[model samples]
Target: MIKVLGDSHDKEMYDLLVEVTDLRKFVEEELHVLWKDVDEVRVECQSRHASNGNASISTSYIVVGTHGIKVPKPNMYNNTRNATMVENFLFGLEQYYEALGIVDDGAKIANASNFLHESTQLW
Candidate 1:
């Protein structure tokens, strides 16, 4: 499920936080990203309006496995493109890992460091 909380007065751009209880299901259905052993996914997006009326947005995605946290690069921009960017980023991530021959192993992937190192090259 997706949960959102923010100040009622700030409608221009409020924080959008989405949490998927069953990440595997969500990934397969919504993202179409194949993964067999992910347990949870949390996405947090925040937008702030500066005094000059300019807005800045940032998004972070956290994938939780039984063993550790998988951190993806945070996206930052000055426009309104949270949802699309997040989806695209995740899709790319899935593809990256797949290309590296890394599949979800119920958090049993012992060489997670290798995967993490390779992911950094994507940036």
Candidate 2:
């Protein structure tokens, strides 16, 4: 289960919960674009073994800020700092427009006339 919390003081902001079997798919499809507005996220995971073995459960928290993302060191029982998982999560948040040849240098000028007319009305 994953829970997302928005601004605390704002009543309009609500919490979101997501249950998933695959973390990679959830990160790429749902969380990639949601990083813009989400302030904090909590993830809970559980695994059950055979009847003779014990069950295990763990939780992790991730905080998002303007400068970057923060993930604390795992506790004694929980170790979720796998290199591959961290790399994948970071890659999903990256903006690759330039590398993908999607940049448009003249995009601003294309709408410059409309912007200027709107700006004049504001005066």
Q: Return the top candidate by lDDT.
A: 1
TM-score: model 1 vs. ground truth: 0.23
Per-candidate clashes, comma-separated: 0, 0
Off by over 4 Å in 1: 1-81, 105-123
> TM-score for all predictions?
0.23, 0.15
Angstrom error at residue 4, model 2 = 82
Using TM-score, give the best candidate's number.
1
lDDT of 1 by residue, 1-123 (tens): 123344453443433222344565676675544332232231112222123232212122223333443545323222334798657655665554454444444222332233333345344
RMSD of each: 25.4, 28.7
What is the TM-score (0 to 1) of candidate 2? 0.15
Q: Which ten residues in a row have the lowest lDDT in candidate 1?
A: 40-49
- Indicate the worst ten consecutive residues by lDDT in candidate 2: 54-63
